[model samples]
Target chain A: MAMERHERFSLPKVWKPRNVGEAWSLKRSFGSDAEYVAGGTLLRTWWEGEVAERPAHLIDIRSLPLLAGIRIAEEGGTGIGACTTLAEIRRSCGLAAEYPALPEAVLQIGAYSIRNVGTIGGNVASGIGDALPALLVYDAELLWFDGSEERIAISEWLERPEDCRRDRGKLLMQVRLPDRANAVETPTGGGNAPFSVYRKVGRREAFTPSVATVAISAGRTEDGRLERVRIAAGGGAAVPHRLYAAESLLEGKTPDPDLLPLIHEAVEETFRPKGDVFAGEEYRKRTAANLVAAELWKLSAGRQGKE
Target chain B: MIDNRTELAPAQSRLTLRVNGAACEIAAPPSTRLLQVIREFIGLTGTKRSCEIGRCGACMVLVDGEPVNACLAMAYQVQGAEITTIEGIASGTELHPVQRAFLEEGGFQCGYCTPGMVLSVKALLDRSPDPSDEEVEEALSGNLCRCTGYGGIRRAVRRAIELGR
Candidate 1:
């Protein structure tokens, strides 16, 4: 099974810390040269051998027990450790049932192998990650430890990403989904669960960066009105965001065919998708609006089916 | 050859791993990529190195039974991991069933992508014995084959499933 060995060269130094506290201390000491790496899917691309800006110290945080595994809160929420791989999330049947959009978003990024090593924390930390929109719709929260432990809503973290960078000794601990168990699965009027849909239209059919992506969660009231609506978009290498205008358009209103056009218009008004070589601003704006409309239609369809 | 059990310091450390069922120890710098260690230090040329970026699946290997892009993994990440490469899939002078199926199905023309594709098929079959067409497509999506168009590879995946069962 052995093959003839080739010559080797000296690569940069890596530090392996056993726990979060030790890792944090290392981060504080190394400053810019030290970067914490879990899966290294995104970070490795930047700090290759002999690169001028290469990270001097690569901190392997995958082994730390503090940043591993998925834990379900006894009170009915889900907490995913920072090192939890996207493949783990994709294969999790429980998470899939509770938050379908999360698994759906994960499966569309890269492919099976990349997903295997790509951590959820890494994905969210990427800033323009595909999973952010879905997480926003699910009301996910980001848990991190700076000098002290702090937790913030994922929406807030997404708004100011640079502030959360680990370079400043602020390390991401885990992502928490609020306890949705007590929340009525079947609302008075329609839908079995909070119907959610995440759609990403990219340059290619699958396993490519999104040109436009949108995720939505909605439930109807006893009178067949839109009781609660949450809509978020932006995965196209553009700014990921929640569409408060679009969500406001549907909340507490009955599902009407005209609402589709209103939702699309609201999305266009809210988001200005940054254009790239693959797609221009107008095209991405149109696609984002279309995806948002499609999800609204899907949630409305689910309510109709229940009715 | 370095002793596999010789423990290095926790900070500046040597990598001790099982590569292709062999307990191997080698000097690994902190930032050394697994792809480099596999092809260079370990001398397993079966895992091709193309596009050092993680986007390309040319440098694919199985670490502890999970398929991951070797280009993206650090050498130390595989320190206690059971590493499997294209060379390790077969046992004692026999091609693994996936390789045989690829041969039967004409899964490749240029053969550059075959090693990664075959290992990916091995990982898929290890998990799902009877994978659906979409599942097969999803599993092999990371592996790009420009030569044979992928009709042959699709057939190879189906054939491998049958042969394994």
Candidate 2:
């Protein structure tokens, strides 16, 4: 009879590869026994008992060539490599112009050094904090390279809480952003194009995680009517999601002073926040609602003035 | 106690680094963090370690002309890479433009965060040459100075940009 040995509290063996091909080779060799580590920011937290069991083997994937750029796709959207650092994303010229909200969210993710080490893949895989809101607003898709296959989608990758806790084998490979026109284009005839605004209520200005974060883009028609609007919020919800109801209510509506209450109500229905150390449910709810109204108002005003 | 004279075998993962215009090699563990190998093995103590986690930019070093946190990077990852620490920022006795700006603008009080801050400024100037105030702030946002010397740091970055131009 063979004996199964369970070593308690053993530090996982670490493997450092020179590039992505070597990383993939290691991933195939170890199968599910290995976990790819880019920055190790999240892994250390788990090691210190802040989370669950660490994978038995750490496969370092920072040197992978495919996962290190923010470039415009031939099809017109932005293509951010999986291992591209938040610092790199924040500094990318094309991303800064096309997806302003993304850079803003990246800037707010951690202190400078964390940005230097933390990768876009890590941010999306963790499925916490600013990444969700930022990507959701941009209608970003996750590209996964399983040992034997590749898959891509916005809705298919993330599970809905119940399914996620049951199993965890999905490794996020890359994030593919949709074209800018698809992301920010309006239905009605455009006057001046809309701009994105990202707002987060955190405990402090820097180094603290967000209590609630919101990213919104609103465009207006030539006649001062709302053309299109997109809203995504995180940190207060079980999973970060788009405020579809709020978005539906906002589109085609003129933002008069009285519109604020209706906008607030629509956004409030989208999220039911729970209390934590950073902020209570009531405060988050109020702030989230207010931020939507304020940002929408500003966008509408700016569009109206330009028209 | 057991005989303490057993010569410990050196963990040998070859690291090829072009550091400060000089090529150097060191044998270390593949898992050894670049910060550890640099400070302990190579004996370059200019880069400080704080938090060890990526949250603090205290151990920042320039890897291939980009600023990266050394604590989060393995030494093996830096093979065939160009690295510049705070020690390599000057030529002989003369200070780099960034260093000169830091000195003239009083960029450090506690001095713990200076190395990372300087490296970050060097990286920004290497790319942008003349970055806006917001860009400078964004670049240095990763570094945390406990003495709240941001005003002077900002001035130093701006001065370095001017001097570089």
Candidate 3:
């Protein structure tokens, strides 16, 4: 690890753009020599060690109004600006109560101080961030801007993240989480919403990168059958991704003691986690499978009690 | 005014910020970490620098009344913001409640991690006046102590709550 003090790197000229268009235009003008920075928790760390190639121009996007608000749509969905701090998202009472996985995931990213400065947009664009799995399970959509604004599903972006960078000057505008009320509720008037759970097993209790993380948003149908089940897993050495194979197999299936084991096995097969210094590849895959089973089992048990 | 100039311009600029309760101005490169500015430029050494990376909270300081890793923050980013370093914690001869609590509860043996721990506790109590033991642990999660096994530290946090009352 490169451990030079902060001043070692010959500092780049910093540009504080006032708006999105201006920021984008600056990025275009600087071409490959300029990099957009929001919180700088991740980028600065990489830049210190020369992991992230140093740019001649550091475009500070912190001042841009285009990336600074968390607005709730009239329909109960949320439109979170890219620069909204992780601390804000972790403490959002409405988001916690409605979409539990988001806050749960955000809370596990780093320590309190890092959360205070780290932004959700920076997390998403980090490519292998802890929040990506939870966002995938929530079916979150991202707003992107090159010259014009466009919205794309997070799941699609996960498959080909490089596609978003085609423009070379693309900016992540915001993340949109659809209204949870739209998710089909229990048919028997149980008044319970879909169960969403996020579990992250790390090397230690807190402030450690996850060894394996799992997020599930699922619920039972009128006949006590599981449907609309979405599962995503990432963390540790693994590339954050949606578990499509497991999701397809579990859909419309009745929750039972046997079913969880099957889902666990399927996840083990689907989840291809890479190994790092913290854990081995086999350990990550096993932990991912175990978390998938345990979370599903708990969710299913809670549903049975409500029924 | 979109100045599409891509060339490398002047890296150093005038940065003005409120430190503790005083307004201050300094010229520095935009990449200068707030930790470096506070220690080297302002000459206040209370905030210790350990792991320059974000992993350790030894360089924690309050920016806008919230606990932040000074090492991770650039001087240019904190322009016009209120910053509180360890040196700013006490009010003259009268020690802050958290500081008094740490002394009374014997919160330090080595004293290297004390400043960061105290700042974390201050940030927590400012937000949640009476935090539970779990909340205390969560609040101080970033600040690590090699000695004391955190028993004394935990007591200090609880005592700080009472002292505040």
Candidate 4:
């Protein structure tokens, strides 16, 4: 039988941890030999693609009630558990309506089957998840259980050096999307009317790694001046970050087509994207810049018609 | 390779899975994947194994009525869930509408990708009886077919919707 053949890489020992504390202790004990697995779809990809070594132990944390379900606040906003699958988020009509780009990005991440097994927490933690850019625009924060519960902004955590976080033994408890995340397309069309967008250019229409991904969110004052403008770039191997230089240029100013060239230059200068065999560094930078530039131009042109 | 038994011995675990409306008790290593248990242990080869990674939906199965990648999921992880593979998709001996539609529409050529495709189509039809062309394309995106150029698959899906209605 094929299974009779000697296998070089032995399968890892599975550990079902009942709670976050147990999961954390297992990781701490096993050190590099262990991995905390929720859906494990992302980890499989990493191991198969040679991006990382296969761990000798997998601590299944999916059964932990502390890391389950989406809680929509009666007042506003939503708190999504770390183990919530991508499909679960997509099926959430209220979540999809509130943060349109999040579900849109989730739908485009992979096919239905992939989404069914992949968790949003794994995606965010992987640091290369396509959802990062959209989540960045929404100003999302993560609650982590590292010894005790520690809540921190996603942007702040992303800014920390990766080496420092590698052995931190922090378990992501849940992600909180504040009420302001619902600032997408209000009919009032007055001061503080917001518009948000997420664009991902992949090698194919679907089921491919991103070439360059960008997300933008801004509100216009009564006179159409940009307010609270946020721009982010990520996807592929790129570590997502806010494009503050480009954002500052568009902020407190009307999104004019004329300023797009300057904003394009700002993105090119700010974002340092990684390159793989499929795309080059320059190509990703250009693509990322162009995507945001084009989106800004569209917003500007729409106002042009109104004028 | 020299110490295979020593490495594989300690990881064994017993799992009970509800598959095809039957209860299956499997004693295997915790390292065993759900696809391996389904095909090797249960002897149900209807779920095709292509890309072991989640990239290919060739090993697609309905876990609690949701389409999931069998290859990506571990046997121990899905022990308590109800699993439905392509073999269990039909209502007994009678050919399922999805299977019949694919047969009439000639949705496959090499026949290697048929089982996965049929299951994927069944998943779509079961959820949304009348799915849009875009939704159909989206659902089948994970399952790759090297034959029929997807034109026949698209036709089969439409026919399945009609037969379902």
TM-score winner: 3
Whichever of 2 and 3 has more lDDT, that candidate is 3
| Candidate 1 displacement at residue A307 in angstroms | 4.6
Query: Largest DockQ belongs to which candidate?
Result: 3
| Off by more than 4 A, model 1 | A1-10, A48-52, A74-76, A164-166, A182-192, A305-307, B1-10
Q: Indicate the fraction of true inter-chain contacts that candidate 4 also forms.
A: 0.61
List the TM values for chain B, per candidate.
0.91, 0.89, 0.93, 0.89
- Candidate 4 CAPRI grade: acceptable
Worst 10 residues of 3 chain A by lDDT: A183-192
User: Model 3 Cα displacement at A86 (Å)?
Assistant: 0.4
Which residues of candidate 4, in runs, are more than 4 Å off?
A: A1-9, A73-76, A163-167, A181-192, B1-12
Per-prediction TM-score to the true structure, in the order listed: 0.91, 0.82, 0.93, 0.92
- lDDT per residue for candidate 4 within B50-164, as digits (tens), equals 8788776888888888788887888877877899998897777889999999999998888777888888888888888988888898899898888678899888888899999
Displacement of residue A169 (Cα, Å) in model 3 is 2.7
Q: What is the C-alpha local distance difference test score of each model?
A: 0.79, 0.72, 0.82, 0.82
Spell out the clash pairs found in candidate 3: none
Looking only at chain B, model 4 earns a TM-score of 0.89
Give the DockQ (C-alpha) for candidate 4: 0.41
- Ten contiguous residues with the weakest lDDT in model 4 chain A: A1-10
Give per-residue lDDT, candidate 4, residue A217: 81
Residue-wise C-alpha lDDT for candidate 4, range A1-307, written one tens digit per residue: 2222311247788877666777787777778888888899988877776778778888787888978988975657788888999989988876765676788788888888888888998988887789989889888988888778898888888887562253567888888888864365643233446777789999888888899999898767778898888899997888899999999999899988889999999999999899988888999999999999998888887777677
TM-score of the A chain in model 1: 0.89
Error of 3 at A18 (Å): 1.7
